[model samples]
Target: MFLLEKLFGGKSSAKVNAIKMLPAAYAEMVGDAGHCQLKRLHPALGVFELHFSTANGEKYACQMTACVAGVDIVFAANNRSVLVSPPFSLAKLRPVFDIALADR
Candidate 1:
């Protein structure tokens, strides 16, 4: 079985744990609420990538590295870079994890 510890934007622990239970190598989450594609970059490295976008046109490409509380995210947008933590919301940006996941 594969388990994911957490997911950004997921409101409750119950929901997060539910996502982890999906029997797939990678899970694709898309809905009116948002779009998120999650996959393990490397289990040992504890790295994962989350490509998510909200209802608007805002776009973000994020890389999450495993850390203590949760993963640390390196976010890139409008040619700008910033580091953020979990529970961060980008409800309007469009995530293209399929492409981002493939490029890495």
Candidate 2:
């Protein structure tokens, strides 16, 4: 598994655009009780997420989770649960990211 950074060098507008969409994403996520992955004061699934549109044109994302257990990786786009890792470092998050991105 690899990051988009390994495939595409330099930043692009899509990345920026996706970052810009986060507020909407969070609002949409938290607005719906079924979609909300939050638990108490902390988000149960993730905080920072990278949105991606797959080859088939599906909206997907790999989110970085910070829960009581510790930091982990989560695939939580469109309220889908593709993958969730045990407490792992940022380096390990990349591989899980690749899996999440490719699932579509």
Off by over 4 Å in 2: 1-45, 53-59, 62-65, 70-90
TM-score for each candidate, following the candidate numbering: 0.33, 0.25
Q: Local distance difference test, per candidate?
A: 0.41, 0.36
Q: In candidate 2, what are the lDDT values of residues 2-104, reduced to their tens digit?
A: 4443222223422222323344454443353212122221122224555554334556545543222122223444344333344333333344334434544
Task: Give lDDT: candidate 1, residue 66.
Answer: 34
Top candidate when judged by TM-score against the true structure: 1
Itemize residue pairs with steric clashes in candidate 1.
53-93, 54-91, 54-93, 58-93
Model 1: lDDT of residue 71:
55
Give candidate 1's error at residue 47 in angstroms: 0.9
lDDT per residue for candidate 1 within 1-104, as digits (tens), equals 43333343232443233223321212334546455556564433435556555677554555654323345444343344344444433421123233344443
